[model samples]
Target: MVKIRLKKFGAAKRPCYRIVVQDSRKPRDGTTIEEIGTYQPVTQEGENQFTVNEERAKYWISVGAQPTETVKKLFSKKNLNKK
Candidate 1:
């Protein structure tokens, strides 16, 4: 199955993540089909901690790409701002 998920990056204490489209069976940081955004968990909320292309994300989801729990929460936060 294809999925939309975070790929861990950055140094040990300062981890960052790249939200990407990849196969579910692949390793967490192995390879990605497309990069859609980023997230930094340690940063304050709304302090440039998350960045996602909503359009692409929606499209991928529509095509059956499952997002991780964290990614789902981020999208919800983004949508709340549009309301």
Candidate 2:
């Protein structure tokens, strides 16, 4: 099954992630179908986060891409409201 999930990257102490579309069975950082957006944690700046390409995100959902629990929460927080 296709899924929307996070692909972890960056240095050990400084972490960053790319939100991507990939096969569910693949590794988190393995081959991806497409990159939708990103997420970054900000300890220095309060409440710094965002999501992009909501239209594409919803398109993927319509075509049967599942989302991991964490991705689902992120979508909810962004108000994507995909089902």
Say which candidate scores most in TM-score. Answer: 2
lDDT of 1 at 42: 86
lDDT of 1 by residue, 1-83 (tens): 99888999999899999999999999999989999999888886558888888888878888888888877788888772221
Give candidate 1's whole-model lDDT: 0.86
lDDT of 2 by residue, 1-83 (tens): 99999999888877788899999899999999999998876446665665668988999998999888888888998777555
Taken over the whole model, the C-alpha lDDT of each candidate is: 0.86, 0.85
- Stretches of candidate 2 exceeding 4 Å from the true structure: none
TM-score of 1: 0.86
